[model samples]
Target: MNTPDTHSPVLEVQSRRRPLAWLVAIALVVLAIDLGSKMWALAELADREPVRLLGGALYLSFARNTGAAFSLGSGYTLVLTLISVTVVGVIIRFASKLRSLPWGVSLGLILGGATGNLVDRFFRDPGFLRGAVIDFFSLFDPYGQVWPIFNVADMALVTGVALAVLLELTGRRIDGTRAVKERKTAGPGTRDKAEQA
Candidate 1:
């Protein structure tokens, strides 16, 4: 059985290196899986029809997307690549500041996903920084064009961002500190006007 954590999140992060490892490990693993799956899709199924993975609900289909999510901004591949590079750079610059588990994991996932796609942008066809990202894995086909086809990297990116949003909503700071609201107390013997009466 797991014991109750008596230490605050910030305290726990400060006391251990394990959380930092978790952040790096998650990023590495996510990057590996995302890229590995993309490689497999490229070699095995690029030209073939969508391979049904689980009934009609999921499929593995090959596509080289030159744009952002849902194939948006298809004409600006280089611009998107530059933006991705900036994002990855910014994330790495702040990687050392990750202290909260949720934030670490969130950033890790985002970093990994960003790196994964960025790799394709660097090396894939159609010249440097203009290469298309290889995506597969279609879902919810029964709904009929309701869900955009995506890949592992995309999955990580979306999940990480969502978790980050939730953490922010609950007043969890990026540095593992809880955002506590300070009560307004009487200061230096000063009192409210009604209390003075």
Candidate 2:
């Protein structure tokens, strides 16, 4: 008569749950910051000249973007909105497989950023699913002549994507495992011991 191995199962469950918790917490924080910044920009920067900062390296100017990131795909607000919705759905579907802290963080940033812009598409001015996104941060030029005006959501999306790409290139799996490369044996007759066994 031996005691049961209760600790293993409990630890496994906690490991699975921890990643999801991090994902949700990070996503909520990103969403809140994006929304808050947008609100502040709308209230304080409206109808005002661009506020220069960092010796003109950055400018805070209000802008309503009717397009995707970097002001691309203008005149296609509805299509862009649909695309964002699809992205959010995909992230949610993938969340169930999250078992790595880094993957969780990457997905969380993407989900939060996508949701932030989606909110604007649904609730901002000019009607539902066709509303413009509030943008305030500008680089180099105030009128967005040098660079497109952007917001916090765009920043998060870009950062998340870059991190995800880096993780993939580094062979970091979503299950917290490092991918291993298989080595080939020299010569045709050289069979590996494992294969022979």
For every candidate in turn, the CA RMSD to the true structure comes to: 7.3, 4.9
Model 1 spans with C-alpha error above 4 angstroms: 1-16, 142-144, 183-197
With a 3 Å backbone cut-off (N, CA, C), the pairs that clash in candidate 2 are none
Model 2 Cα lDDT, one tens digit per residue, 122-179:
9988999999999999998998998999999998888888889988887777766666
TM-score of each: 0.81, 0.88
Candidate 1: worst-modelled 10 consecutive residues by lDDT: 188-197
Local accuracy of candidate 1 as per-residue lDDT tens digits, 1-197: 98767577865656345546777888899999998999899899987877876668887777888987556688899998999899888877876666677777888898888889889889989989999998887786622265777788888988988988998787776656676545568665543221100
Model 1 lDDT on a 0 to 1 scale:
0.78
Predicted structure 1, TM vs. truth: 0.81
Instruction: Give lDDT per model, in order.
Output: 0.78, 0.86
Q: In model 2, which runs have C-alpha deviations exceeding 4 angstroms?
A: 1-7, 186-197
**Cα distance off (Å), candidate 2, residue 59:** 0.2
Highest TM-score: give the candidate number: 2
